[model samples]
Target: MNSLLITSTEESTGKTAIALALATLASAQGASVGYMKPKGTRLQSNVGKILDEDPMLARDLLDSTDDLAEMEPVIYSPTFIENAIRGQEDPDALRDRVAENFAHLATDRDLMVVEGGGSYTTGGIIGLTDADVANVLDSKVLLVATYREPGDVDDVLAAAESFGDRLGGVLFNAVKDADYDRVSTDVVPFLESRGIPVYGVLPRKRELAGLTVSALAKELGAQLVTPNVPTDGYIERFVVGAMGAEAALSQFRRTKAAAMITGGDRTDIQTAALEAPGITCLLLTGGFQPPGAVVGKAAERGVPILLMQTDTMTTIERAEDVIRSGRTRDEETVASMRELLAAHADVDAILQ
Candidate 1:
């Protein structure tokens, strides 16, 4: 069974999303493909029953399973890593475990996609990171480069050099039309001269992010507040704690606005937000029993309430990743990202 590890030099570089897209495209081409997020922080569980966090999305996009635990492992807290290293737990041990799982999954499959952690050089001291794990699995890497500027090229080259002979190729992702022109015109030529193979430069589209949100809402059975809201007007800045609500609200008022996600139990916060005009929707973080009064207040005021089982911190982190990496424009976004990965991923080359 042959496999390739998809990694990036930083978080929100479209690593998981790109891997899923690749799997989907490859599958459409009639290649038997399977995907897995080797190491992750959050696990999807519901009312004593475990659920695949993004099961439907995974299946719909990549045509994979939600029942497979190895598909995504929850490894969020710092304590988890500490324990894994001290042998109190084997959190990072996912490298080989996922490898075996992929080898098994690849029995009749054409290609196995192993998605990496935050970045290739991300393992903490005293433990193996994604790069080390890739080495252990002896899999070549497919880098997801997400960038918006010229520095992106340097970063991608950096990662490529760090991975050395393990570099399979590069995927310039989330690019805009203009950026793609600059890259394939100037940047790509330079890299090619240095012996790098730019596998594919994918364009940036709102469809990708929209697909994630829509799938999440369907999986959680959460309702959309404003279905007609333009993707461009969607809220980009997210505030987690109530302490920042005032600023968040003020910012939303300036923009066309989309949704305001909060906690169902946060009546005080909800009421305060209700009093404010110019807001679109409200998302309650925790899955708690909503009181009739709160529901009445929200409905009467025409505010949409989205309820998510995940806590505030987890929700915030997830939302941030989606927003930061969710720019929906054109080809330049992809080219810029690829260039960035090429620069920063050169850990070994830089050290030398």
Candidate 2:
């Protein structure tokens, strides 16, 4: 009977990660939890099957018996969005489908964890936004926001107005250590005074954020030129090799466990990256191929070379986006979330 909808202020705010963590936490309390994502946005080829990855992950992780199709009744595909915007798709009808799905999962369940797509405003075109669906399900809302700057406080205030009485609280997740003091001292007090409940402030530790070399290649759709190289290395961050070879080498030296992005033609920079420590993978841009010797050196050093079609700027942006989007997948991340939420969040209140 207790249904909770997990949404966020922006995309890639670890909604799925936090949802999975909360579901497990509730289960540990002897409550039978059911999971559903009424709408999925990150559709991808999961093991050669094209579907929404989030729902599949939730289903597999929870060991639920509900069909994937029923668990996620709607996907925010391009065609679906286009039809919805053109008035061919009905909002209320789609919402009814979501409600129907929830009905199936609610049997003998003590709690239901529903995850919204993209952001709370994702389904606004069809009028089935997170707030809309939450109202339909009569579920309380938990807004998981990432605090990148002080201005992020505005997003929480705006969400409080939208959720109104249904707004359980706001959890400041993925808050970098640098911004911790400011959020705890200044931001938390401001929200609390204005009748907003600040549930948790979780830090962005490297273990929860790093992406494997294999995941980077898979998510980016890049071709791995060196197939025999190490693919499991963690790329904690990425750097662009736009500067001179000496300058770029200096950056590669300081950065640990990173993917170096540069043009394939910049053989000197590529060589420097190979020489530097902790270069897990090399991303070659603009479809250019590095020389045989460069490839040989990379392979010799056990570094994987990925060929990307985008230019330097676009490649950098895409890499950053991938890191943010793929924040949670493996069991390692889920385990880390348990400790994090227990330490910083009011889990008992959030679930109840």
lDDT of each: 0.60, 0.87
> Model 2, range 64-118, lDDT digits (tens) per residue?
7778888888978888999987899988899889999999888899999999888
Question: Which runs of model 2 end up more than 4 angstroms from their true locations?
Answer: 46-50, 221-233, 236-258, 272-280, 286-289, 292-304, 308-321
Model 2 residue 150 CA deviation in Å: 0.7
The TM-score measured for candidate 1 stands at 0.62
lDDT of 1 at 21: 53
The RMSD (Cα, Å) of candidate 1 is 8.2
Q: TM-scores for all candidates? A: 0.62, 0.86
Model 1, span 276-334: residue lDDT tens: 56454566787775576766776777665667778877666666555654334233433
Leading candidate by TM-score: 2
* Backbone clash count for every predicted candidate, in the order shown: 48, 0
